[model samples]
Target: MNERVNGLSETAVKLDRAGLDGMDRAPPQLDRLEREFQTFMREVDEAAAQLRLKAKPIWFGPVKADIDAESALLKDERRKDPPQQEADAKIIQPERLDPSQENGKFAAGSLKSMDADTGPVRAQPQPSGAPKMGEAEKAEGGSSDVFHRRLGPINLADNLQAGIRAVRRNLLVVMGFTLATNVLVLAIPVYLFQISDRVLTSRSTDTLVMLTILIAGAVILNAVLDAIRRFILMRTAVEVAAQLGAPILGAAARASLHSNGREYQTLGDLQQLRSFLVSGTLLSFLDAPLTPLFMLAVFLVHPDLGYIAVVAALLLLVIAFINQKMTASAFHEAGNFQSRANLHLDSMSRNSQIINALAMIPEAVKIWGQDTAGSLKAQVLAQDRNVISASVSKAVRMLAQVAMLGWGAYLSLEGQLTGGMVIAASIIAGRALAPVEGAIEGWHQFIHTRSAYERISVLLKSSPLNFERLKLPRPQGRLDVERLLFVPQGTKRVVLNGVSFTLAAGESLAVIGDSGAGKTTLGKMLVGSLLPTSGNVRLDLMDLRNWDQRQFGENIGYLPQDVQLFPGTIKANIGRMRDDASDEDIYKAARLADVHELISTFAQGYETMVAADGSPLSGGQKQRIALARAFFGNPRLVVLDEPNSNLDGSGDAALLRALSHAKREKITVITITQRPSLLNCVDKILLLSNGTVAMFGVREEVLKALAPLNATNGRPAVASQTPQVA
Candidate 1:
């Protein structure tokens, strides 16, 4: 062992000397040295293993001393030449060695001559047909793929399936309870049979008392189990709601965006689904499958009685099928009419003030009444059919019970069955048919719930939930629009086309055009509220569509033509309803919008509650607050459409101040306006004519070009074209 160690030390010294002298060693010599080093390492490993095995024995002391001495010698040698030892450590570090380099003639650190001249080893060229590390994991669908799968599809069916999976254990437990409950249902019939066969025949008071107590106990236990089953179902409904509510709402919101102002009833649909979960209708469906078990029980009592129960159940099912066929179309029509009527009523309610002032209530009511009347007529037809079917089903059930009793009595008289068996058969037969009757009675509810489920599924499929995007750094306010084009959904009319422009960081541009020039649409595309049919809107060279929505929103501020505030405190509205927003941010936004003093005059100041309709605050106040909301968090870009339309003189002055503040902060600004006041504050002007760019250049240049047209037309050229821009 000592001789081997000496030989290894001598070889290392020779290698270090060769490296210090910068001698270019041949590949063969380096390979030979590498083989020797590997053999020495293997020997050291074998010696360590032997020492470990001998560690527990009395002879281990000499081996332990030899191990320590070897370790000390290695440490002393490492200290003698720290830099060389460091290079050796690098060679031994598994992570530092490139696996691809292993196939080359010289292994890592095999050429000691290069160690003195090179800083770190370079990666070797990979062999042909070999996958890079990243490509290999990508091919195997690694962590990123797993993340995407976890996101899943945002459709209703997948979300519902996920929710069901989450509660699968609870569902299994509920099924167990249902089975026990159904089995306990036989206690009534058994008690009746015992009373007639034992107590009546014996004429024993003690027997009657014992039978009463047993029947009472069974009834009590059955009720307890039923209660527990209902309780579990109710809790399951809540859990499902908690799991699905947010995703459903998010999908609905996205659906609304692409729906051309069509409103979705998704929340109502979700509520209906939750209601169905805990309804008696669900319990009836659950028990319907167990009907055959009850029929089997009746068969055990008497084969003739079992046959009667089966026929009755089959008859009721046939009736249910008939009822569904008779009313399905009517229920579907009613649902459509009801949805239309609701949408009409909601629109009317939002415009109630206008309707009343313009004496349009009668016209509005007439239109709404037509839709309501159709809905009611369809509902009436469905109800009529439902009632008739239910009545017939009830009659059939009663007659079946009577027939069972009559047959049992005849069999008893024939000396084939006991009297106690007669009443028991009647009760058990009724229990078997109860679920079928319940199904008939609740058929309308089942239809409605099924329709709701289908509608929700369609809504989700039409507008899938947004997946998480990678967060990019905050933008520096540079804007680029490249040949952007937009056509509204479901229409052939092009709203905007071939609109292209650029704005450096902190530059401001005013968009001026005719009434139908697509200015609002362009604004929406710029802020990513509306997607373009082609081309791109880029901020900091990253496409707007690719930016993480929440992060992107944080960097951009937008005030639309109609400024509608959300229902919350003034402070919340300014902070975009984020709970984490600090008071300082809210105040800063308020001050930037120049509405801080107006807000302070309010009794609640920043805490003042505001409605969605902008009550308690005037139109000017609402517009100003909305401006503040857009300016919140010191957004890199701000877009304002008709910002001063409702502003008074003071409000207009405040708007100018806000624009000046934005300029000082180097925030990019885009305003859609026909007002000369706004144009004066902008660096450039984009004149849109019929959705196409008419002129785009420095503000003074564009205005000078329009000067002749204004003089010739006897009016301001932009304002004459845009009569709707107040």
Candidate 2:
């Protein structure tokens, strides 16, 4: 055996060297042979190790028998005094005798597992210096417990702040450009001074040409710098949007699941914020700080010109303040009205078919017109105030320029200032007040952007991003709902109260209830779409909240009552929009839902386009396609609410076949329905009435129980119950 092992090792080394030397030249057969030889060598090594373990001394049997008997006796004693003896018991077994040794001597390491009827070994105390488990987990990231992974609610405000920090470098570059551009702008006034004092007095055409060329070059450079600053700001805005876009959309999607009739204006607010970033308003803010520098230039010309510039700036500032005070409330009110108008418009667009079919367009328009009129009225008021303030600010600025020129003229006549000084001071004074005037003009936009920022901040705080959850193994569809209770937000009515049920893997349950009897709510709770106000929903002994949402979603399938497909190819919709879904999986899902042949009848087949608003296809077709989507990816659990609501006879037969297929595949299913035909395909029935369980048992037993109730009431048990739950 040893000789064979040595020979194999030598052969492996020779093969390795040969493979490296002739890797490119080696034939496919040679590579295959090499792999086979390596696998054989591994098997030989394992077999040899097992043989060595089995090889023992002939005289070791008696000693092993004695140890086995002793072990058996110790086990018996432990059974008699189970708790105390099991805690304190430690058994010693004789070590395997070395095959080469004639004398039976134990190895040195054998004492570690042995104890001679000693009392329970006291656990070794942890060293004072060592951190406890909880402390270690905290150092890593709070507790390892599912409910307390973080120290407190996630600080989503920091997430928004972090996006700004990510673009800090670009902002700094913009600021540098702003400074350089402002300094270069001084060239115009300086050129005016030189042309008036030097060129005109000297009558030197050469000096005139030089000053024009120099000032033109400075103007061009300033334009180039300004363009670069704007480009940088635009890119920074895009980058910030990209950084926060996914997280914001994810939060909105989660918020939609929990709330009803709550409009999510986060995306629009983000767009407003981004537009403000790249707008001229931001540049005006940057230039406002350099206004004092321009004022200082005017001061260098003459103190009286400086004083005029200061007064103009002060007056403009006061006008801006008045504009803000007057228009702030109006703009805010306009924004609120505009949001409502947008919501109404979106609803009308989504239900355009219904409006057209019912000929309700006139009434819809009138309703939306009211909201639009309110928004327009508030906006018109705000704009009126803004225009008035801007006109006053403009008058103050032009008056200041006129005052500077007139005063300079008087000073020049009195021989107190030069003609060049008069012209330069007038130009410099206008530059000094340009920022304040521009700011006044853009004041309304500034107010809107500030309002958007505040709204976005509040939205983020209310709907924090989901925390990273630990990935758990795929569940086997063993569902246990224990005393579930749910009450809708901002309402006193209970939708589901003390609803409890259990379903094992492969079982099919029919959840039948009257309209508004909480069947849909129960289905949502089972699929993890809606959280229970109390009690637990466990899958495979693990709480639903403990599983990562993405992973949990991948394992469970859901089809809501209103079947809506995303705007995409039929193949994509059936594949649940997953880019990675294979052709085989798509075909299998369609076949399982009995939709494959129906889809094939279309001209484009699976490649046919579909819209969220049902188009081209009939209501039954949409329901069938949605059913296929639910069965896609072979989900372990499938929840279908009103699965057969739009199904015809043929579609109903297909659904029955699908349910049977699900049972055969051991995929647990919870079907919410009012139709009695589906109950025949299910293994069990759960009847709900007035947000409580009316009856729950095996199919025959439940039907038998309901049979007497039906007879007494002269109607079906479910249909007889009144709608009480929301």
Candidate 3:
């Protein structure tokens, strides 16, 4: 027994290196004899035959060699203990081997059983003499999965908090530059005081030259600091945009998929935030609180002058507050009206051809005008209030200046104030009130931006998609819907209910139903474009949600009822905008769908530019090209809705050929069709009616049952072909 074990081990080693060198190799007949010892090898051969995998001579030889080596090991073990085999069989039960253990040599049957779980069984290669994947492998960039950007809980507060964090990251440097610029601005008032007091009183050329030089230097320093501060703010805005861009855009896109109209407007809010960051209006608000510094300087000059400055500042602030209170409601209404008008404009523009064909342009124009009118009226009312407050604020500011001069003249006569001191104090008072005036002027912009921020914050806080999802391998296209139900958001109406079916790999099912029968919704759920409200849609027993969407999407082919296309070249659309899509696969898909000749008719062939929604092509041309895209990469699962709606006799023939080819290639197909001619290509028929399954059965049984009913009664042919659910 020991001698036989040693000989078989040596034989296995020789077989592994058989093709490596030109050594005179022994005939593999010795290994073939070993194959007769194992019952598992015979079971595997039968399983492979059931799968219908054609065995090429070249491929079969290598497989036989491998089986031979495995059999040899088993034969040597059996020789060691003939009687131990029956007893050891209890210990070597296939059920005891973990399905996930790839190293289990006698667990081949476990591979087939792994499909009982919710995911497809995929074979992973274990490199000979290689260490197992671990933290070291992960650190070396071995993981292919990526973590998506997560935008935490959707809400206004969280959005604001995110913004605050970004700002605080560089707040210290920004603050330093801001304070320095403000301090340099003080030099202007000080220089003016010295020029009036020292240079003017002395009336000396040397004193004037020295004061002028000092003031010029201070002005240059202030300019430099102001530039640096502006640069910092701009850089901060860019960084904030970069950090939050992906998450915000992803949230918006996800919301849009669920028909959240407000989500589309979220992008506008992001723009507003970016604009506010770079705008000087926010900076003016920041500097407004520093106004008291100027007021204190005035007090140092003379108590009477200081009192006037404080009263003037308070009056301006009162007018500003009045402006805000009067215009807030108006501005909010105006924003809502503007949003509706924009939405209407977008819809009308997209459907302009239909409006013109129906001669409804005048009606559309009137409706649009009405929407715009409401927006305009609100704007005008807000503007009227703004103008009134602004007028009062400006008049008070001018009045304060004139009154200060008059009061100074009186004080100078009494020898309580100098002329230079009065001039300097008035300038300080005006500087202190400048921010108030600026705020009033920019109040409307601030209101619009604030409203945008609140709307966006809410969108950002709404639930986000799961990032860092498990990366499951490609499915073999077995589809299962377990009592699935789907109800759209904010609606009690159910789109689909209690829909259950099973499609084995490489089988075709035809879904036949009238309008509003939930056929479209079923197709969407199967392709993972929409989620079921309850129950599950699984591929290979695993729920679709559990599978990584990006990888799963690569194995799926979907054709929507509307036949939409993006703005790009013909080649790009067919390739689904994949950068790695080969020209061979693209051309092969085009040929399979019989669109190659049609595309060649165009001046640029594959490079021809396609308008959005494939608007540049005729209905038949669009459907054919879309079919070609669905066939791209020979995807495992293909779901086509109303595919032949626009196709002519020739196009329908081409579609039939494509379906036939897809079946031959072992692709699973679920096609929704209004025409009965398509039934010949499908093996099973599913009839849907009013969100429930009317019938589901083999194609022949359904057609035979329905034909007799149609012959006896005057019922519609399509309905007659459908029997009650069994």
Candidate 4:
């Protein structure tokens, strides 16, 4: 081993010293070998250059010594512990090599290359203790927390915070004006004191006139501030309502389709909150906080007066607490009953025709009466509690006034107080307790507002679909459903499972199913009206949830199982109730649905008025109008669910012609139906049963497959020209 190591070292040293010089001095064969070696060396140098291997100077002698020393160290370590082996028992130091220089150079070079590729190092994740930037901003800046929160996930505190933020500006104005108004109130008592002490005693006409003018000026100032404050609060309430009106209605409308609670209650909650904002009850609340200031003024009058005022204030507070404790639960129950009754009434009114026709009015009335009676009983109980507390509070207030008067007279007789001071002290003491008395009187209203706030809070917690998303250009009507599943809320039954399909642009497909087979639900999902529980429904390769709903709605048309027509003129209904819908667009849609001639039969033509739910218009007329509206704007994708349910022969023919025209225009159509007539126009068929696909293929193939089943059931198959599947 030592001889081999020495020989390698000698070879390396000889080559380094004499290789270039000896190349020319050698024989031809030796020269050829040396040149070939140099060529191979050059190739290696080029390969190393490509690999970015930088060469550093090193000595062979030190490397040899280090290897020998490392081997000796390992042997010694192994001999000391034969059971275990250590690969790095001792660090070998190369005396001729600078370890720091080589390691530092290589590390620095590698780091420079990586830094260029990856940029700067990223910071570590934030600690749990760190507050979110949005939360920090909300705390520092006065922004509505409710506005930030959605309707279903938030609590009452967040709602109150939002309400406070909404009226924050007006509240500041009101507080300042309230202070001014109450301060001006001081002018009245001061004037009374001066009148009795100075004007009455001295009999100075000029002083009396000056004092009267100053007091009148203060009264005018107080009235002006009060009016301004009231106006600001009123406007603020209107502004808040205006801002929240859309969100509240949006929530209620969405909730009505799914949520069990009274959907209309949200509207009432908004009304109650706005009324509270503008009501005298709110003003009294503002004044209640100034009760302490009035008591302090009374204290300045006399210690006896101050003590009486404190006792009166404390008594009113206790009475106020009793009033809330007694009436709150009753008020809450009454409100619940009232909302429930209202919901039942709304449902009844919408179905009044059926109720009256079936002679169900008596039974309906009995149920409504029960609800109303329950609500009335709760209201009466709450009022009774309120009246009792109010009577007791009034009695206590009267006794406090009488006691103050007696104390004042005694002090006056004892020569410790003047007549004017006695009068002033009594007045101030009453003023101190007045706000609390007012609050007790308005306790019922306060409770109602509190209830309204709570309901509104819950309504505001429901999060709407986020409309802020990447805007894509209009879709090409290419629909894709991938492994879709839907389970309705609060139900264990699945409506759809693993439903996967793709529909190309400009293709027509008919969805046919037995009753309760999720046909309507499928149509709704396709049109982006309802979301899938799992997987995805996409249009033009983009998820429908990510699409801007309003923008998507403009390009997509849907006629639901139950057709709805807004209260409007025939022209407006055909034009989708859009104010900006042109006459040409309206005429085109009406013509497309073949409703123009039927509409023309009316004396007023397009100007014919339609009642709510398209009342007074026949069912066929409403369905035709809805169909026209669905085709309005020439939507790229159209979904029709049971479109011909109420249509007559002429209406049916019109619907068929409309479908043909839509196909001609390359509109992708998905129609949910049970009729063979509509099936004749569709190119493909999808038959669903028990929430799974029974058969899906070209209309011909699906109809052919079902032929055998129909024959076995003793039912004739649909004519091949008008193929159908059941």
lDDT of each: 0.78, 0.78, 0.74, 0.75
Q: State every prediction's TM-score relative to the real structure.
A: 0.77, 0.79, 0.77, 0.77
Residue pairs with colliding backbones in model 2 are none
What's the lDDT for candidate 2?
A: 0.78
Error of 3 at 235 (Å): 3.2
lDDT tens digits by residue: candidate 3, 1-726: 455456656766766677656245545544553763254456655665433222111101112234664466448546745674543242222332333543555333433223343333333444222222233222421222222212343233444567668777665676777767766777777777887888788888898788789878988998997788778788877876765566677667767778735467667777877788778776777668778888888889998888998999999898989999999999999888888887778778778878999999999888888889999999999989988888888888888888888898899899998788888888888877877877887787799888887776676667443433344434557787889899988999988999998787678999987789999999999998888999888776578887656656766789889887778988999998877777887898898777898899999899998987576788888888898899887677899999999999988898898898887766799999888778888989998988898888889877766665555676544443344221
On residues 618-725, what C-alpha lDDT tens digit does candidate 1 reach at each position? 999999999999998778899999999999999989999999988877789999987777776788889898899999998777777787777677764464223222
List, residue by residue over 1-726, the lDDT tens digit for candidate 2: 576567657766666788766666556646666686677788886775444444321121112234664467447545645774443232222332232322653344422231333221122343222112333222322222122123222445556776679668787888899999999988988998898899999999999999999999999999999999999999888987876666566566768797543436778878988998899988888899899999998888889989999999999999999999999999999988888888888889889999999999999999889989999999999999999999999899999999999999999999989998898888888887888888998999999988877776666667644544544434557787889999988899998999988777668998887888899998988888889899889876577886656667767789899989999999999988977777887898898788998999999999999977868789899999999999887778999999989999999999999999887776899999887778888888899998999889988778777766765766644422221111
Instruction: Pull out the clashing pairs in model 1.
Output: none
Q: How accurate is candidate 1 locally (lDDT)?
A: 0.78
Clashing pairs in 4: 150-460, 150-461, 151-460, 151-461, 151-462, 152-461, 152-462
* Model 4: per-residue Cα lDDT over 89-197, one tens digit each: 2222333223333543322222211123223222234322221222322232211111111222122233345556879878988999999999898888899999999
* Model 2 regions lying over 4 Å from their true place: 1-159, 260-264, 716-726
lDDT of 3 at 552: 67
Q: Alpha-carbon error at 618 in model 2, in Å? A: 0.9
lDDT of 4: 0.75
